[model samples]
Target: MAGSYGAETTQGERYRLSFTVGGLLAPQGRALAEMYLNRMGDGSTERSSQAKVSEKISEKANEKSDKNAGEEVGESIAAIRQQAIEENVLAIRTDSANRRVVAETTRRLSALTVEELAYLAGPDSSTSDREALMWIAMCRYYAIVGEFAGEVLKKHYLTGNTHLDFEDYDRFIADKATWHSELETVSEGTAKKLRSNLFKAMREAHLFDKKSGTVLSFLPSPSLADILRKRADSFGYLPMRESSL
Candidate 1:
């Protein structure tokens, strides 16, 4: 999150492994997508569109009885928008008010294709679809997350394993850190936060049991799979049986 959103594996490229962003936050994602679409439909520029979304979030915050709490929420969302702009995720650079949360959120949202984003924010998407699609978005956005999905989750399923433990995550991270200098630099506390957030996201996506840590059985719907299949390397992020794919 401290560096640019993402980079290729090339030597000259800027790559930094960041996991400071929290879980899926599906509700917030949907809200932001809806607001973005609406603003675009109304002929607002990308900059203005994000500004409007921030304002709307602020207005909603203002409705709360506690003025201080309301103001804080407004400020946070507004700061996030400014951060997005500064990162060039949203057009037009601004002051550096945004932090890792802003960088991660904007990068995640941008990772999805317009069709994927529309489906995610639309009325027809089921809860499961939204969760799965969000997972796909995260994979597409962050190489670290995508590699974990492809390496650990997919391998675990293929090997007929149905459970995941912190050790699996620790081992994977440790192994990857050997090659990825970006990851090698992470402190233990940051790595723990990364693991916690990842597990939470998997649970929310219904890919893991909330209480038991058992790998849940899930496959994307045919329509959803079809959408993902159209994109190179995207469908493989999901842990699916070989025959199912």
Candidate 2:
């Protein structure tokens, strides 16, 4: 059966299902973050303690939009709000693996306002701004993408191929199911959803052309290049135009 993005909802969503920062929420997200920092603060100590960010988001939604805006994401908060933070708030923590990484980078990121990252998620940003957000999102994607899609990205995408089609995805899933007993055939349906959504993300990030399936080149902005340099090992496994940059 032919599949598309979000197609596997029936099978269940994949781990790397979609980019949560949809390029629409930057202003609101930023406002919310600043409010969060004001309400809670953006320091390491503050982030270590959980803030009622969803409560703020709900409040903002009610303030700005029709009352119906409150209806969505009541179930959406706990599951995804962290990814938003990861992509938007603490993005300066580029290659965080554990507590040590977080500790080492706090000097660089701690004083920064949480709302700053929301600009990257906004609509009226530059091409470089868009690329910056995409690159930041990719940084988080590497941390969270499961073994199967991660393997495909490392093995297949890192090679710099220009195109990857559905057949390639099918083969990758079949192979992952073969090697990982925990992810046996029973989960292939779930794996299919994962694969499709992962590609959807790749497309949205401009890593590939969704219409043509052509893997596009990644041109990291100077700032992004600096992050990549600082966090080279973090990105060593993933595909990019140039690693050292």
Candidate 3:
């Protein structure tokens, strides 16, 4: 009673269809494989677009951050300069010669090139030069007992040497006394304002740190100092003394 015709006919049809499909698909399959290989060898536009978008986003973010940071630094420098003016006036009243020295120092500092100022402030570092100058100028102004201590520290710092020896600092102070004679006649108010602005500028340039509230020891390089001195001379300020030269 088995239907041999139905089973045999279905098996033969399936075999014929399988052979026909395989023969037809073999070329198509080879073409698809070659297309895949070519695509793998050549990158897609989507990847390039994605990379470009990522780069643009990063650049915009950095620009925004830099703009905001610059504004904050500007405000900080303004505040420090105001304080310097007050302190400079007070210091001058106490000692005229000290006032002269401070004035000369400030004038010299103000004359530095932007690049030189950057180098002085550790621009590559976190702290700004303007902030550092503000703190040092403040220390110079208020800490009458240790007037030139900050400057000496700055010099030592620029030289990549920070010696906290009291004797050495004292010797530096004594040596600076010789330069006092070179001070020009500058008004107390003007001198104070100048010192304040100079230090503020230094902070703005990233030569000093404002957060620790400590003055860093960053001295101008000799070449940079010479450049500053020349600028100062152009501006009618006293030249670098022989000892400093």
Candidate 4:
């Protein structure tokens, strides 16, 4: 299970692609994905220049939003593009093995369900994608949302339980000293980061109830379900454990 983005340092804060997961699962995300492909231009991805790609994506993004929303679309798209780049879904090589490549190109954009894309965009959307996207995200955060958290959630928060208790978080946090292979112990700062990455994003995505952090049922959006219908095998773990969070 490959994870998502690594880590991004803006104003001295360490954030993952986790913050923007909801946006990618929303209706707007479909448009964003389409715009991303369109910007690729015949799949050759001649658009290697970030400034140029940003300008074009921004223009397209502006066309579909209110003045205020439009203002942030470019930045948002650029961020997505950057994340995609980090994930290796996009390539920016001029040439390889005498194969000269001048700029960035779409490397391996998967045709995904809204749910799958959502899961990809959001770090903790589903157990399956969580496994996959979590790895990609780990490259940046240097933290692992490994089986320990999942196992704890299953044993303590799950087991005929559909909801979660803060105690579960406390347990995970207390025992999260071995998540990342490279880290000798999970630092307070790192645990806090995991909280933000896992719990916070899960809340926003409606995977857990706000007040209690209770586990939620799995209900794919209609559009997402339709997309998943043909790709069920790719996500064979449906009807997943509610506590897989």
Candidate ranking under TM-score, highest first, comes to: 1, 2, 4, 3
Query: What TM-score would you give candidate 3 relative to the actual structure?
Result: 0.23
For candidate 2, what is the TM-score?
A: 0.46
Model 2 Cα lDDT, one tens digit per residue, 1-245: 21221112122333233323232222233333333333332232233212354444334433433433112112212232344345444344444432222221221122222222323322334554444344343433323343433455545566766567887766765664454443453455665665565566566556567787676655566644443453344343345536445
lDDT, candidate 1, 56-148, per-residue tens: 444442343233321111112233455335444423233443344455665666566545555566666788988888787677666777888
TM-score for predicted model 4 compared with the true structure:
0.42
How well does each candidate superpose onto the true structure, as a TM-score? 0.71, 0.46, 0.23, 0.42
Model 3 per-residue lDDT tens digits across residues 173-241: 355445543223444555445444433433344443446433343444454444344333211111113
Model 3 scores a C-alpha lDDT of 0.32
Per-residue lDDT of model 4, residues 13-97, tens digit only: 2222222122112323333444453443334345356455545544543344233321211222343454444433423342241
Name the top TM-score candidate. 1
Worst 10 residues of 1 by lDDT: 68-77
Whole-model lDDT, candidate 2? Answer: 0.40
Candidate 4 error regions (>4 Å):
1-32, 41-158, 170-184, 221-223, 229-245
Whole-model lDDT per candidate:
0.62, 0.40, 0.32, 0.37
Q: Give stretches of model 3 more than 4 Å off.
A: 1-153, 156-177, 180-184, 215-245
If both were scored by TM-score, which would come out higher, candidate 2 or candidate 3?
2
The local lDDT score (0 to 100) that residue 67 gets in candidate 1 is 34
